[model samples]
Each structure stands twice: as structure tokens, then as C-alpha cells.
Target: MTIERFILFSITAISLASLFYIPKEKYRQALVSFLIFQAFTWPGTILLVQFGKIEFPVREFTQATQVGFTTNYLFYPMIFVWFVIMYPSKACLTKRFLHYFIFVSFSVWFINFTTIYTALENPLAGTLFSQTTRSYITFFAYYYISHGFIVWFSKKSNLSIGG
Candidate 1:
């Protein structure tokens, strides 16, 4: 298989396996995260592609679009659940800030790197800066929104993050 296919399939498998570990109560947050992630990523990617911000080599009737959507199906829920579960509630501000910084920084870089290596040859038409900016924005938005929803839902439902 091509590296693209391998990466996608590996993420798919790992994602499926990860689901088994999620507490039943937390499924709601995962679902919400997945939906919101799609809400952002699907259209955002299409606009980027159409506007020449990015390109996918695949050209079979929106298969390229499917790449964006499907890969997200794997990653977003896992990330949402993980962040909620690992939230350091009692940590000092410095530690919490470092956690957010590390995850966001790494996530942005890995996500952009993966996009360039697997889905696109490169960001297109002088869109490297724009695409990079958009990526950081989207990912940070995802992180905050995902975490916020989990916190909110947990409060409303009278549940803990893992319970």
C-alpha cells in the first residue's frame, strides 16, 4: 500500500481499538467532537482545495474529500476523548499551560506534516502561510471546543470525565 493508504488504515484501526477503552458515559462527548470536527474539517478542506490552498492527488469523484472526512473520523474523537480524560484538574497553572502548549504545538505540526506528506504534495498557490495559519486556528479551535464541550456536558449530566 502507499504511505497514504497505510497511514489512513493504521489510524482507522487504532481508532477502532481506542473506542473500546472509552467509558460509556463519555461516548456523548466523543460523538459531539466527531460531529463538530466534521463540521469544520469537511467544508474547510473543500474550500482550501477549491481555493488552491491544498491539493490531493486522488481524483476519483471527491475521493480526495473523503480523505479529509474519513481521516478525521479516526483522529478527532480520539483526541477529544483523550484530552478530556487526561485533563489535569489539580495541576499548577504552569503545568497546565505546558500541557496545552505541548499538545497544540505538536498537533499542529503533525497534522500539517501529515497533510503534506500523505494527502497533498504541498500547500498550493502561495497558500503555505495561509494554510499554516488556518491549520493552527482550526486545530486550536478543535482542542478548545472539544474540551469545553466535555466540561460542559459533564457538569450538566453530573458525571466525571471518565465516568
Candidate 2:
């Protein structure tokens, strides 16, 4: 496999493996969050790609392939699952704001940088710093809204596995 594919595959593997470590009782909650996040992000991604804002290349910076679909559909959702789980249960407003800022900023930077480093380019590729910064802001908005829903849903119900 090409290096790009290899990297995507490796990440997917690691993400999948990480899922096994979450506590069994918490798995259902995490899974619910994962699915809910995917429900929104998946279609949001499609719209971005369709609008020429985001691009997903295959082995190279040419055609795209669904082979690495798990990178988004699986890997990200899994990561967010853990992110929600790790959130401070009793955090104050400032702490929560700081945590979300740091987490979202780093996450967005990592994703955008990795995409470019891996030869993928988005519509804002010309202004590297600005593009990434804007994307970070935009993604964090989505993250907050979706993650908030997950948190709310989890707390509002006693829904767990087999419930």
C-alpha cells in the first residue's frame, strides 16, 4: 500500500483498538455519542466536499477512495466518544471552556496539518495558517453543538446497552 493509505489504515487500526479499552458500562453511552456525531458530521462532510471546501484524495492527491472511509466514519467518532467520556464531570464554566478550546484547537490543527502533509488540500490551501485557523473555528462550533447534544442525551436518560 502507499504511504498515505498506510497512514490512514494505521490510524483506523489504532482507533478501533482503543475502543476495546473503554469500560463496558460506558460503551453504550460512548457508542451512542459516536453514532450521533457521525449522523451529523458524515453528511456535513459530504456537503463540504460537494461544495469544494474539503477534498479527500485516495492513495495520492488524485482520485478519492472510500477504502479509507473508516478514517472518518469510524476513527473520528471513536475519538470523540473518548473525548466526551474524559470530559471533567464537574468542571466549571471556565475550565470547560478552556478544555474545549485546547482540545478543539489541537484536534483541528492535527487534522488539517495531516491532510496537507499527506498531500490532500482544501479550498483554503493558499493561505495555510488562515485556512487552518478558520477551519478550526468552524469545526469547534460543530463539535460544541454536537457534543453538547451527546452530553445532554447521556445525562437525561438511563439508556445503556440492552436498555
lDDT of each: 0.65, 0.70
Clashing pairs in 1: none
- CA displacement after TM-score superposition, residue 144 of candidate 1 (Å): 1.7
**Model 2: residues with Cα > 4 Å off, grouped in runs:** 59-68, 120-126, 156-163
Whole-structure CA lDDT of model 1: 0.65
Compared with the true structure, what per-residue lDDT tens digits does model 1 show for residues 82-130? 6666679699999876776666666567667775666623566655567
Question: Going through the candidates in order, what is the number of backbone clashes in each?
Answer: 0, 0
Per-residue lDDT of model 2, residues 1-163, tens digit only: 7666777778778887888889888888888878987876677677767766667665332345422366557766776787778787698989877777776776576677666677443453446777777767766776788788876876665578797
